[model samples]
Target chain A: MTAWKEIDQHVKVWMNYARKLILAQIKTDVQVSTKSGPNDLVTNVDKEIEEYYVKQIKLFFPNSLILGEEGHKDSGMLKHQGYFWVIDPIDGTMNFVKEQENFASMIAIYYNGKPLLGYIYDVMKDKLFWGGPACQAVYCNNEKLNSPANLSLKDGLFGASCPMVLRNYRGINEVISKSSGARIVGSAGIEFINVMSGKLCAYLSFLRPWDYLPGKILAETLGLIVKTIDGEPVNVLSSTDVLVATDNAQSEIFKIINNY
Target chain B: MTAWKEIDQHVKVWMNYARKLILAQIKTDVQVSTKSGPNDLVTNVDKEIEEYYVKQIKLFFPNSLILGEEGHKDSGMLKHQGYFWVIDPIDGTMNFVKEQENFASMIAIYYNGKPLLGYIYDVMKDKLFWGGPACQAVYCNNEKLNSPANLSLKDGLFGASCPMVLRNYRGINEVISKSSGARIVGSAGIEFINVMSGKLCAYLSFLRPWDYLPGKILAETLGLIVKTIDGEPVNVLSSTDVLVATDNAQSEIFKIINNY
Candidate 1:
């Protein structure tokens, strides 16, 4: 595997650049429109930011396959390649357009479909979480990161979508309710960061590929599980109920989700 | 009545000072302890910010009664006081502590228990929603804000306690389903801003006095309904299931809530 230290440096450059563009492009008189429903939103800022990140990827690493929200790129599928970057230029766009905070710019680099680097920047706060390369995965703002404990769901908090709490989703409610508790931050990148830092034992949300990839790379590198809620291995090219967690958390969570 | 221009100056001066002290006190490693439950968190930042605002209030207007979160306040219930201030120095403390974002600073000032001035500041975005004292009140940042349409419950979105979306919570689910959709921003001040701005037709949440006062002032100023789900007027010093909405939205919401 390539040294994550070198890759993190390169990814940070692109992440920070997109962060600047995103902030600059955010309109006070934002053009707000519903996506799936009213809860889900896509502002011009979201689409523009995603496009900006895709542009940067093609310029810096022309051969790198790009996967992004807003259909900014079409990597088609994960392939053994020199480099592939997954980007969610503005994760939590509703929060960005409405509240204007708690959103992030996320990107991940994969070398031959294995983790090489990951970065999720809290644009407003100027803090970034990044790492990959499982043997010595890291997570932080240009600081060292320790791999989280292999905690079970019962031992820690979980971050997830609201449907899971209402038992509207499959085995999620049972699996999640049995945990210490749940925290829904409404962004995959933030939830993914929570799992990597041990703030959360697991995060289960119906997320698109761009939303899941950066976090998935970061989670897997931190020795955490990144799988579907049904315990199926994730299909990287499509959206899924992605569950990212520590190994012990995954096993314990699987028990609760097994009914599905 | 004092002009909004005059009131804005005073409210903003004090808020900026409070925000500065708050900014200095809060950081990633601040001491955090649980409150109410594991899900609820309180940091030293909360206490310090409220105290600073209290001190500023004493210096600026000695006669104004003051009510503040963090238990540092000493003022009676909303009465026919000549001048008074209600402050939630740091709203969304859970988000502030865990996510370190999405929290806000809020204040509602009144003369004789009538809405005189209101403010809800998204600290990260540095945008303040402020206005009051009128046959009709309005909100804005440095510029003027045009009120969004008084859409019905079936037409606009709602923000509320996630619990309201499920288990009926007084038929909130049906009321919400009638709406285009729902969003849970996890901050009363922010949620209330959405309601006042008409981005959401209604907001219902379990709230303490501190959470209600500022939003209550703003919602009422916008020709909207502000009350408990049971149709009781919110007591300025009580815990309640507070609801804020336009008149039409309120009617629709209450009817459904009554049925459930």
Candidate 2:
């Protein structure tokens, strides 16, 4: 228990530190460029923030394994004991570089393949969603999470990847046309906040491990569905097309996405 | 000039009033229900606010036509000599009902088929994007508008409806996959904020007049392309697929969508 508390405290400190550094860079003229194409933007802030977290991780917890989005440590090993830290120093890099609002910093800690901690920080909003399976508390900043009002896709909003909608993403169009309507917030971190806050009925994305790990921890803690679209158990180490929804909402989404 | 200034003042005053009332309704346990489905939602606040805006519009400008999301007015005839007020009293209704954070109240005024005024109030953020073709001054709260850095889709981020990319609405997927990245914030008003702030290269959605009307006014004022998917003028009284982008970005998007 003390170790858990220690880990949480240590992580909290690092997150605040990273947040300060990142926002400072964003407020300045940081050099920006493209990765895959015109829309996929990356900035020096993403790299600098990640390196800051990694340096702290190595110094305080040398035994812990690190996996990050910037391709810093490609040791290519997910299986670890003691502790493993999966980090996206800037989870929504495009949003961070572009919107400067919706992006997040995500970090998840696992012990012996058991989820222990997750944190998704929205810098612009100044909100932090933090928790784990072992901890009974999932918090937004200092406030405890109130379980989202029970709602289904037909009754609530869906957070979806825009590209998926056009490809007939297995009834996604139908989902939007049928639902109150669809909303597309650009960042996974913001989407996770919406889900945990019970704003969106569900959020599904072509997501990577670091992109979702922290959100998965928070969502699961708040009693939301965190799984692959096919209803398979999520393998946190891989990038999976995942859905995070309320229990009742999951069934409705499943019926829709499957038919699409 | 007197008429424009008076109406602009009226817009700002009523926008603030609507913002407060909407926020108050959010804090209250207002009634909420599904619209088309769970993804689509409506609260009593959305309805009341629209009614309130219409009342204000008809009171001040008795002959002005009104278009709203809650089916408030008839925009069938937007003739010359008077004004047409396009209002989405509470944009991002789902967010207002569910998360209560990401919504906005948008208003746009046009006269003789030309944009006269535009305002998108980020109630939660307390920031307002306001200007018009006649005003030629875009302000967020009190800050004056400056020409944004000219960036292409490849050099910037984009906002699209989540489901639009999957089924190939104008080859959005190929365009998105090749660009910096995509973000889908569920609200057109909010997405319009991204474009006006110069964060997004573009935002494309199948939107009605109320949905894209204010957005078109602001996007145009900010030197962004807000047009129909095909090469035609956006009919402010009709629901259509609208694209708001930078010049070069729009050309790239046009090429891609046309190809698809």
Best by DockQ: 2
Candidate 1 C-alpha lDDT tens digits along B1-260:
45656667877987787677667766644677777776566777777778878887788677778888777666564664577778888898766754455679998887877777788998867778877654256556766666656778766767757545445577676675677555666789988877776667888888887888877877776678898888888877788899998888888888887877
lDDT score, candidate 1, position B175: 71
lDDT of each: 0.74, 0.79
Clash pairs for candidate 1: none
Q: For each candidate, report what fraction of the true interface contacts it reproduces.
A: 0.06, 0.79
Over A1-260, each residue of candidate 1 has an lDDT whose tens digit, in order, gives 34656565666777777777777776554687777776678877777777777776677677778777777566444664678878777898756764456688887777777767777888877879876664355657858888888887776767767555544577665665476555656677877877887767888888887788878877777678889877799977777788898898888777766756
